[model samples]
Target: MSPSDVSEADAANELMRLAKTIAKHNKLYHAEDTPEIADAEYDALVRRNNELEEAFPHLVREDSPNKLVGAAVAASPLSKVAHEQRMMSLDNGFSDEDIAEWLARVRRFLNLPEGEPVAVTAEDKIDGLSCSLRYERGALVLAATRGDGQIGEDVTANVRMIADIPQALSGETPDVFEIRGEVYMAKSDFDGLNARLMEEGKAEAVAKNVAFDPAKIRQFANPRNAAAGSLRQKDAKITAKRPLKFWAHGWGVASSVPGETAFDVMATIADWGLPLSPLVKRFETLEQMLDHYRHIETERADLPYDIDGVVYKVDRLDWQQRLGFVAKAPRWALAHKFPAEQAQTTLESIDIQVGRTGKLTPVGRLKPVTVGGVVVSNVTLHNRDEIERLGVRPGDRVLVQRAGDVIPQVAENLTRDEEREPYIFPDHCPKCNSEAVAEEGEVDVRCTGGLICPAQRFQRLAHFASRPALDIDGLGEKSIAEFIEAGFLESPADIFRLHQHRDAILARDGWQDKSVDNLLAAVETKRAANAARMLFGLGIRHIGAVSARDLMKKVTRLEEIGVLAEAIEAERSGIEKLPGEEEKKYRQRIDAAVSEVIAIDGVGAAVGHSLADFFHEPHNREVWKDLLKEVKPPDYIVETRDSAVAGKTVVFTGKLETMSRDEAKAQAEALGAKASGSVSAKTDLLVAGPGAGSKMKKAAELGIEVIDEAAWADIVKAAG
Candidate 1:
């Protein structure tokens, strides 16, 4: 053959090969929980194939992987349902600003009046595979997975097993309706499944060196992967084996709907027995909606199901119709996603560290990986149980992901090496050489070294100076590490002694006089920090920021916390001897005391116990004593006449007159009134400055008082 002929044949074969490879990878990723390639690698392959197809349009084949959704539909017993409206996937937004831009484009296209408030309903965007169900006359007619935007495979029988998705709707039902939702496995459920696998001895054993070990059955990489695999099973019984849950997010189509508002429609759906995301909030304006998003982000870790981000939709049906559909997604709705929680990185080493509570935590040091733009080098292995379950050993290839964008954790071990040695739980603490014992009903094996462990000291110091703890500027993790390395700082009290070595630090390599001065200045600023900040900075095992604040509120003085801790401990010991009435009273008192100690909005029992334990510990008290000699924290402020918002319910709308919307909300929160989203009779003031939109009109119609941003500022100033 000629050179040109050979080249043509080679290109054709290459195209075919790429298509097959891409399709196989997609199957593994989307249907099987077993990804053959990393996301970056997969993206590169798709991009390359797209470029090739674009360059040679005539060569494109209908069955090419570039044109397909993913793998073929799973061989399930469920009858397939053809969708009335195709389940299209929405484009993702990575940041708040990205969402704002999307909203702006929608507004611009719709020619919405400037300064008109756009009411949006925000709900948790469940991290799971998308599925749609159709019901006719209250009875479920069809169930299908969102294969591609245009086509989907039916899985009616398999979906019927999901108890949360109602077989029929209640009351006056629509003639035809379509429900859209995500199918997911709870983290706890996933963990439990893995645990059961381990107990049953179905888990793969660690390989000896030079021997090949197969991948473990217990590991599913992530919840999304696990859920997808379960849903695609040939047997309905197999799908049922996985703890799958369905949460209704919205509707695709509805005939003869009774409600004027989307919320009303959702209420009907919830009444009909569809599980809805509990985090849904209806806001009157964009500001309130954003605030709700922030609140959800703050509380995301505590949620039962996984959420990638928040989804916002126009609350009013009329407005939604007015906005209409764009390309694949609706113009009236936008998905405002949180930063990516999962990331892939090369595992460098796995080291053990001791916590303040003396618990040994395995920390995996990785090649710095960026998730949601934050660099993460270290992730928690959780416990010895997790180590054994994952069959992860040092130097093995692993995937790291944050639990909920807060706590870093290892998601999977990708390399299937049977010869890899099993990680044995240490009998003694790696930090202090003290005996490590697993507590009853607990997974953590703790060291008995208490506060003396250097590793624990370093961890505590770093935690103490964190933003939510002491918030001491210039006293970051790097500075703490450097100080620890130089043997200049150890205990919490050592922070105040930095002045003693200011010259030495300044004289050291990579250090200058100005930097040294700044460090000392930051240390001085923290000396007068609030009681809550100080308490949190101490690095008590269970005492988190909220608990520290709660403790501070009840005790008023740092020293008084010790006494309260002792009293609580004594009361707890004598709980069995008390009369019913006395026990009730004692319980109330204890509850009140505990509440007061950790009364911050997000604080809980775990944090309270840590705080109590810290205060009661002789070593911690001794550290506190030594620390007090060098630096005294600010006096506790029990009562103040200044109101955060003076009991007034305030609503902010449109572009602010002076500060940004976020700044205005922060100011409002700092002052005292509940900053609300919508206009109602309960609303005291509607801050309608420049660009005030539908919220201003609604506020006026409802007879709720309205004020400008300047007026809102004045109110806050007066309260102060």
Candidate 2:
């Protein structure tokens, strides 16, 4: 329920509950470093707590979590280091308007006029554990983890193992310096570590003569957790095995001045063998800083390391000294954060979905909650094994994450104070009365009823007519369901034969004569379809629209793809049934075919396997042959038009206010232009927005045409 819907008494009760719950979570996150919930979900809890407090101020507790900055440091075996100068946090700004106001407030505090220029340096806020390193007389003295504002736990031995950390400074070193930065694990390294751990667990289990349990493996929730847990290892040797990296962003206490500006000091640190973020930029205007933030956001997924936001700090030391402290945060620095990618909500129930391939995947039906600005009511549980690993149950408060800044998934289930029953895996398919079975070494449980299953039938037909596929007009989820139930549609081929049901469709509720005509016209127009679209419409497992396009780029006709699939399957089967030397030749043949198919960008081994499996299956083969009888899709072809950007590569950066990035790319492609994400030497044109940063600068440096949305529109019109 919403805050406004709650009564005063209920609000007070909830406030008390939230206060206690948040306090526990704060201790778990800050002190223990073993958070039970995600950062986004914790933020939601705190936000809800604040809302409750606002609604019922009279019930404010003395032990409220909001009143504290950091929790008391938990006692550790390592010696503690008292900070000479307290390491404070930075306040967050979520939007450009908030950043503008923050800058204005900074100017006011510094007693500077509005016209006076204030330069700031922006750095990527690495999502990792913060550590402080002390150097004395050009030698590393100590290293400590930021336990609290005042003190930290010494981890000098662990720091000495990290190659990124400097053991001894160069000739131009400071007499006494303390540098602060984040210790993070790169995504690639993190994955490698997880894989190694799983292998080790399996090896150890084999020695002990027992089955390997996935729960026994040390699997981290994310890269940050992996880095933190690695750095805090009691044995420095173990820490060295974990691929931990560092980036020096700021400083704690310094005896001698290394540089006059923050930028210069960071440069000096970088020269001392400490890595710094390449995305860092020095800006003289608020627009530049905001632009850098936008650029960083767009490139977040591509970066080697994870970053929660960007930190902007006053470059001038004198100005920073003037704007000192605000309780627990620095007045000169601000962290501009992106939208929350995780949220907490009640798990109403668990539902099982049967995909087109008959794979039974569990989905979490969640109470409506907004995450990453999207209201999500359901999240993928992935598989039964994943469900067991999470240990989630109905009515549990689960933390849902928008993984990869995209698909919503249940990350964790916060164990409640009370006992609850574990969720049971279904033995039969939920949509159809068929036994569900899982093959040996396979994670997913699938229904045995193949195409006869109602669930698979609906899903396959819907996918065939989906926008990313054939894109049939007047055909949506509701219409497909209604038509299927009315016995008018059974197979994808039935869609092309819908002309025979014109009178019946017209007589149905909400169906008019014009709508029927339009639907039939749309279907008729798509009879001559593209190879990629028709292939995607088949809904083969692991064959998405992008992969279909990639496959078609190499093979023109659907028949050729089918033949390639058969050849690959034949080679693979022969290799699998034969032994060492005899199978080698067959394996080489399989590899040759796979290599050719995988040579096409975006097509991987899994896609190749799925394609082969689809063609090899008798039922699917029959369906393909039957469907081909009705629809004759055209061969893949490239049509280059006579336009200004016909053979040119164009790069787009920053927010496109008038149109979406996808729409802009589509429009560019429609004009025979190739839309590229990055600015390079090959880029002939760059479309820059109000907050365009590095891309715009690169375009100018490369002498590329940099145009705004309005100018892009004029060019499009001229090309037309």
Candidate 3:
């Protein structure tokens, strides 16, 4: 629906979800250096948020995407540094019209005569980690990342190792200056890094008496990610080993001004032994600026480093200062970004693939087309709602962009209006004939068959053998599917019994004595398993590798998962249908009967509900019992660093204005506190915000200490 058509309540809820979603992506891209979505997808979400905010200006969220600059640097091992001048990100534009409008705005802001010439400097914006290098007495002293614009992680030792960054100035310079630049890895260097990492992984596997599996090796997805990961290392040695390079773009906190113009200062930086963009030049008019942008795009493929766009800024420093800043970007500068690469193709058919979680994802089979030199045959339709939104049917023409890591993304359905019939989405699982339903407020329809469905079973079994889970060397997705097709594998327990079918396996193609031996031996080695990995492998909802590990830190054995599930069920059962008892009393009767699982650090209501649902199912319980009988997973015992709230149960309620709910949970975990969903008698503290409702009242009645977001932030800062 359009922004104008959406209800205020719906818009508010969507904006809330969008804030959380965008925050997650920001953390993945900026902090983790492992992006989960393509740039186009991320931009689409931001654009949607902007539209909603525009339509409902009164309902703008405090944690809106507009207010965020970058991600926080709190989780890093390195110490933090505060930037003297905020390292701002440039606002982006995609078309020549946008550039013209920006120039018009600049002229109007300065009250300049129409048709007068304005000098604007254009430079390549390389995709890399933003770093600020501070020099005192013409000598490099500190290097920090551009985290959240204000505070950043200190990487002084790491930047000193980069050959491109000089330890000291070459000639005359400011006594105190900070040069802001991009720390990047060239395409060739990135390829070499990935190759080296894979070889080292192989060597380590061999040393551990395990078969080599190249698929298990972690690799940098792109040059940008490689550069970020290399520079943010805890060890300076690792950064020195990486082929990291830098180019100066701007300056900050200078003791004195170097030049009157941006171009002049950039040249001074280059003269002072820092790398500057070779193509940097001043443009006299909008046409010249746009031409330079097009020229850069034409030669982007030949550039040594990855650059997403060209940045243009007012040449005169006086004019820039006069224009001043917007919220997160300068009013005088704009980034002209290249559009995502696209190709026209026909949507031949749509196929639904069920994931381990039973999520039904629609994939569009396309006529073979080339996009940015890569041949694409498939496009991800995302979900059932996306299919309906696109109004696409079989044989419709569509535009596809090469965006995702594995497949192209469906950009638009060109023949939507010419559709003969609307394609009907399946209400039942295409793989198992089981009823599939989309949960309320959810876009993706999922099969409720759980473990009984063959599709879910195959997916779940494959997940159990994945690198982060069981880490079986020879077991892969295709091989697992083959075993299932042959009826040799019924569940995860069947994996351990594979040795019994040795002669049967040998009769099949691609089966050898050494290969089969390696596969079974790999399974045997994991008999003494890490309980955390085992729990993650079970494909339980809301329990990821990290959360599984967090939960295991409290539990002695994997069997407690079922016990916790039962305790949760019993608590809910007792509360069910208490006539004349309001929803408030159900929570008030919180004696010792409440499940401890829900109160465990990092394991809250969401995870407790998922565990309860899993254990309540007979098929899931049978699979769990059979799998445990085959493989003996020992207790998960590990140490967590102590903090102020280390054994205390804490509850967060109401609208978190500055941070997302997930981020709040992460902070609680980092502080070694238990983040619980419900406020019970055990809750030591209640972090409440506006609209706290029932939880806040309960906390008051229970006499728990209440604090707001700012207070919680102080607690986190104190812990740090």
Candidate 4:
């Protein structure tokens, strides 16, 4: 509905709806590193909400997104830190008219004459995670994320590992200096990381005697996500491996200013062994500020790091302090954001791609169009609902967007002619011709063909040989695809039967005698795969590594899965099959068994149902029967240990001097304890480190026993 035709009640309802939507996007962008909407689309929503509120001032909601800076910090292994000075967001101006009005407002507020100069510093606003670094006596002390304006995640250990972040500042410095900036991964570095992941994946595929699938490589959605996920790692050693760089943009909670103006202070910061953006410029008028924004926009694609906008902050520190902030944003600074990169292209067709989980995703094939610096020919339609929302057709001219990552998306349908009909979403599995069903509360339509679909074969085989599953050394995705094409392997059972094709594999083009020997040897070693790994390798829907481990802990033998399957099938057929109390007893026993399976951490009803379904399938039963004949998987077992922390949940926090957090958790697990990642009522112990914060506090509040590193070491010795 148009804004002009809306009633006051509708406007109020829209405001509340927009508030919730914006808040959800904030969390997705800030905490999850996954944003559903582009920046331009988000801005448009905010603009519309603001306009509605303005039309009816009394209808302005108290929970309006305009009064918010950032999303609240999500739960993490990292301890939390409260900021000494709140981090504020900048007000945004999108167009020339918006910039002009902003300047006029600033002039009016400051009561400056028309000809008087208002020095502003225009700098590229880095599109990355915001961080604050505190230095005490020239030594780096603390580092944190800008979460919810007030509280943030303490990532000092990870931050120290960044090469650009100095352990000690050079030259003269304040007793307590705080440097605020952005942590970003350069485009080249991001590309290198993805390439390395792909190569590693390919190597693993070849090791498993399978064909490598480039599509199986894992990649971050964007460089910003790569930086955030790397920096927030529980293991600092892992963070150190990533290529991350920092650029100082401003300061917070400082003892004293380094220089008189923002520009001067930033210069001083650069002089003191800190990196600053070279595109930073000082402007004397609004026209110069706009020109600088334009210049930055033109050079954005060429810049090594991503930048969505240019920031114009008042140069004089005195004026900034005088202007202060208005709610969630500063009045002394403005962010001139560039419109999202979009291009008009003809959407030629939509194709369905089935995933390992049997879910179908619609992909749009489009006429090649250049967006940002990349040529995009394919875009994701997301789902059937999204297709209906866009009213898109095969011949429609759609607006495709390139935000981050290499994947393009159809942002809007520019339908000028009514000659084309709306695209019909598929009702049947495109590969297997099975009925495609969208389960309750699910956006994806999945095929019920189970092991029959040809498209799912490669993925299922890859999963069987994945690191978390069987951990086959030489097998990889590429070799699996090759083997499948050669008709040498069909199912997990066929993996063990690979020895029969030894001579055939040796005759292949890329096959070497030594490599083939190694691959066969790896397959032989996995014949005695651990029960948990064996269960995970089966590729049952909803059975992740952790869930498989948990389920194995409850049931010892592979045959127990078959027994449980029989019980569930009997119960489903009705207890009338049994007579009198036998029926009641059987029903009780089956319920107890199912409950035990569901009791495992991360295993819910969906997972339990999927497990039962797999076991009941006739084809799956035959496959399992064949697999069991070739491999005698060891029964799940827990060694008896005399330790205080045995069978207990232990949470580790802060920095450990003797060992990394990963090592500490590994040690805890070795002692028969569960190494949990968060604090909870079930936690029997908290392993507090040097800079332990929220976890320690919560443990104390809950009266959960807290032990330092020394005590933990003593416990380890005693357990040994």
Model 1 CA lDDT for position 142:
84
Residue-wise lDDT of candidate 1 within 114-224, one digit each (tens)?
A: 887666788988878888889999999888887645456676777777777788887777899888888888878877776666644432343333332333444555567
User: Residue by residue across 1-720, what tens digits does model 3's lDDT show?
Assistant: 899887654565577557756876777777777565566787778878988988976556546777678887735679989998898877777789989988887886677777788899999888889999999989999999999899899999999999999999998888899999999998789888988999899889889989998878878766787788899999999999999999999998999879999989988899999999899999898888989998999998798777878999999998887676655678789988777778898999999998788888888899998775345677778788888899999999999875422256888889999939899999999888889998545687989898678889888988898866888888898889988888888888899999888788888999999998899899899888888898889888667665688677766688887787788888866665444646435443432234353565434444555677788889889998998889878877776566778768888999887655655765685566767788899899999989999998988898999999999988888886
Off by over 4 Å in 3: 1-14, 201-211, 342-380, 389-400, 403-408, 412-720
Candidate 1 CA-lDDT value: 0.68
lDDT of 4 by residue, 1-720 (tens): 577877644464466557756876787788767666667667778888878866765555435676677877865789999999998778788899988887776776666667889899999988889999999999999999998889899999999999888989999999999999999999899889877888889899989999988867767757888999999999999999999999999999888888889999999999889899999999898889888888888988899988889898989998776566655787789988887788899998898999776778898899988776445678778788889888888888999886543456778889845776668888889999988998653466887776678778888888799765898988888899899999988888899999999999999999999999999999999988888888878888656555677677777886676676565565544534467768645544544455454565434344555677787778889988888889888888855567888889999999887766656776786677878888999999999988999999999999999989999999988986
Is 1 or 4 the stronger prediction by TM-score? 4
TM-score quality measure for candidate 4: 0.56
lDDT of 3 at 564: 72
lDDT of 2 at 486: 89
Native-to-model Cα distance after best TM-score fit, residue 471 in candidate 4, in Å? 35
lDDT of 2 at 526: 83
RMSD of each candidate relative to the true structure = 25.0, 25.9, 12.2, 15.5
Worst 10 residues of 1 by lDDT: 1-10
Q: Ten consecutive residues with minimal summed lDDT in candidate 2?
A: 58-67
TM-score, ranked from best to worst: 3, 4, 2, 1
Residue 213 alpha-carbon offset, candidate 2, angstroms: 2.2
Candidate 2 displacement at residue 627 in angstroms: 80
> TM-score for each prediction?
0.42, 0.48, 0.56, 0.56
